[model samples]
Target: MTKDWLTTGETAKMLGVSRQHVVDLCTRGELTFSQPGTHRRIRSSEVQRLATSEFTREQEKSLWLHRALLGPLMLDPARVLQIATENIARWKPLQRGDGMATRYLEQWDEVIESGVDAVADVFTSKDERSSELRQNTPFAGVLDDDERRQVLQSFREHRQREHAAV
Candidate 1:
């Protein structure tokens, strides 16, 4: 039988993020892990659940771009959350009949209320709910145009290099 737990590296590979990101998830209490000896061991089941929420290439690209907000989110979450809160309020009506999308938006509010760590989790999580909430993101103006442009350009360059290497 397959082992029921995974190493940080294994979890990262499954989530398409760095091992350190997996550690961060544990630190944020998003994923529970056991410390055996010196390494962190996460439940394989939890990792699989996250993996199942797989984003399309475009969604992954968007998420990668959003990683740029990690710093700002950590540094001044209050301002970032204020913008997101306003965005959510404004867009609620726009969602009209898209219940799933609206529900995600409401969830975003809860994540926002939960504080910085929770919001950060949403930005980095591979969970299906997180992915859905990302589509209805309330962070419309968190990043300035220059920061957004830089992140987009960097993502483009990275994708080009990835293709070239392949």
Candidate 2:
């Protein structure tokens, strides 16, 4: 019966983890599998038994917190902020070592740097005014013919480039 089994991707979806995490579990002897041809196949019964047997306090808490975060609390900005802070705190300790922590630290650093670059982009473009102005603003009626022609020409060129791809 164990000859036909679920693939790593299938098991990962059922277990709510990534394919890499499943691979780690297999390597650590937490999960058992058989390599047939080009794929690793895990027995569903074994996975289910392991899932049911492991009921540690930390695991329970993690599940509950994960569900809560994905539910009604998802719309609450404060809750989102608190959860992000908790994740960063958990990540910091792991970051001190040269293993998974290092990888997480690098990912977090990139995320923060990208955010800074986005903010910088908005400020840099703020001073460069376009020909179009707000209807209620003082510059609404000041647009000249040449400025209007320049805007139309720019738009036409943009459309031409966009349609060329199709």
Candidate 3:
């Protein structure tokens, strides 16, 4: 018996069984355990195994959605849409019948939802520097050569003055 042996209570709770049942499992060789003297202990991982439930449909759907849209939409949105549409068309109707198909549909839905929001979020979240400069800066395309030269000359003089001071 090792000191790390889980007590009967921990083992029972993990296996969703009574303390006696855990003892029985240990006795019957259905579950592996450790004992330190007369005391029993179950590993935390063993307990987690019994407590954890399989993923539900909604959870699977949400995960699929998040993963599908986790990349930039602009580079290949059409290809994305095409793949999504094809997969959805093939699987959406039979979603209840197959876990694999359900996953595909969920992923497509996630991609569309996330892609739209992501695009909007990125477009609206312009940095302060870009926003301020965009508003203040004149279009250089419209500037005559002389005007551009004057602006450049003024910038050079400003840089020289700052350097001299430094």
RMSD after CA superposition, every candidate:
12.6, 21.5, 22.1
lDDT of 1: 0.78
- Model 3: ten consecutive residues of lowest lDDT: 131-140
Judged by TM-score, which candidate is best? 1
Better of 1 and 3 by TM-score: 1
TM-score of 1: 0.63
Ranking by lDDT: 1, 2, 3
> Ten residues in a row with the worst lDDT in model 2?
128-137
Model 2 lDDT per residue over 25-131, tens place: 68767789888787778999867865665432223322332333233233553443344445555556754465543454444444334553432232222221100
**Candidate 3 residue spans exceeding 4 A from truth:** 1-5, 50-166
TM-scores for candidates 1 onward, in order:
0.63, 0.34, 0.26
lDDT of 1 by residue, 17-89 (tens): 6566577668767678899798889999888765675445455766875688888888987888899999888
lDDT of 3 by residue, 42-160 (tens): 77665565447332222232233323333523456656455645655664686565553355345445544576554323223343322222222212233347754665566557557
Where is model 1 more than 4 Å wrong at Cα?
A: 1-55
Local accuracy by lDDT, each model: 0.78, 0.48, 0.47
How far out, in Å, is residue 120 in model 2? 32
Model 2 vs truth, CA RMSD? 21.5
Residue runs of model 2 more than 4 Å from their true location after superposition = 1-4, 55-166
